[model samples]
Target: MKRVWGSFFLAMSEAIVPLERIHSLIVVLRGQRVILDRDLADLYGVTTKRLNEQVKRNRRKFPEDFMLQLTGEEKDKVVANCDHLRNLRFSPVSPYAFTEHGTVQAANVLNSDAACDMSVQVVRAFVALRHMMINHKALSVKLAELDARIGMHDEQIGEIVKTIRQLAAPEGPRHRRKIGFHPGNR
Candidate 1:
């Protein structure tokens, strides 16, 4: 029995999503990286309608933060941005966007071996993106620090140059012109 279940799971997990494909499916919306329901359903080996039905049945599992219904404008933008999502442009119902947590919850709600395996892939994809963002953030911070240091040095150097120029100047008694017309012998 164990061997049979193990083999079944292995077979189900055979259809793996390429890491790049998964990464492409993740989009930033409302300041959160999320996968659209259609894309996620395709990855999980289910119809979009079926996936939505499950989400509706287990409504409590998905909160506003985890899943969101896209606005018409946002939907239009998504469709325009992704060539593969052109079909969605004609879809009357706006698609749902699932965050990382929502993806895991969806897998659980789906209760299938494929969903389980694919959820892991989804999580890994999100994590890989997060790591990249962190690396970029660190690099930016380092650049800002270097720029500040250079700017401080530049200011100091300018002051030093000004002082040197002042010190190198020749001091002489100044001949001043009288401000008002000086009346001599009239």
Candidate 2:
């Protein structure tokens, strides 16, 4: 029975936030990929208010790179992009956007078993996202190179086609005097 209960708990915790779900929660804000305070709080099984309170108490731990409060425009963009965050569209306060490091720090400050576990998952998700971005950048570079090469080849092919067409065209008529008889000489 102990083994059965342990397995059941494991299943439940694994379902808390799948990697794909965490990926969807990430967004680019202010040129940095971040997760919002509410999303992190949900993953950590805490209220956003509680998370913010804890963060405020440990304010020294978080730095500019770790976290930042969104501006009104930034908040509006987030609300527009994420349907679930529509509630923030009218809120007087702007939500915090946490960087990868801030996320781990938040988990440490919270001191919850679930928060600690979710922190690891969040890191993994962030790492995966970074790798994917790098791969996409490489692919973009390769595509640009291919397009440049094709452009050069197009010019060469056009010259070849023009030359072929000139060669295939028939020559103009040629006139020659009679070899043996000429009326003027007679």
Candidate 3:
């Protein structure tokens, strides 16, 4: 029983790391969210070479939309922007970038218990990130609408202030009413 419990705790701890690490691995390439092959390998507890081998074996499963090999320029850009990828800067081969679906497919091809477990967390992280982006976009739209409304009100407010100032100002010297009755006027 103790051994079983120990393994369960160990698995849980291992699973916890994937959720956190996978989120950090996610990057934007060509405006699409993707994870690099090296990063995915690290997450799956495999070597880059092994991971690439599996991907190569299952080439038909990964369509263009699912996976793409980063160009030299793109690879350089990734290395430049991401400090964690500094080691990859000297790598002989440019890394293959996998979209959300591709990452899932890789997990299926790897066919290891760890890969399957981590894949679930990876997918969860992607979904969470997507939801956050959607919410941010909606909030931005609402803010823009509020800004437009405020701009319209600014002109109206200025006009109201001008009218109030005009009403409050003394137009000219006020004519005094006669204290006594004026015979001519009567």
Using alpha carbons, what is the TM-score of model 1?
Answer: 0.75
Predicted structure 3, TM vs. truth:
0.83
| lDDT score for residue 159 of model 2 | 100
Candidate 3: residue pairs that collide = none
lDDT of 2 by residue, 85-154 (tens): 9898989988999999999999999998888988999999999999999999999999999999999999
Q: Root-mean-square deviation of each candidate, in angstroms? A: 8.7, 5.3, 5.9
- Report, for every candidate in turn, its global Cα lDDT versus the true structure: 0.90, 0.89, 0.86
Q: What would the per-residue lDDT of candidate 3 be over residues 135-171, giving only the tens digit for each residue? A: 9999999999999999999999999999999999988
Q: Clashes in model 1: which pairs?
A: none
Off by over 4 Å in 1: 1-12, 154-186
Global CA lDDT of candidate 1, please? 0.90
Flag regions of model 3 displaced more than 4 Å. 1-13, 18-20, 172-186
- Indicate the worst ten consecutive residues by lDDT in candidate 3: 1-10
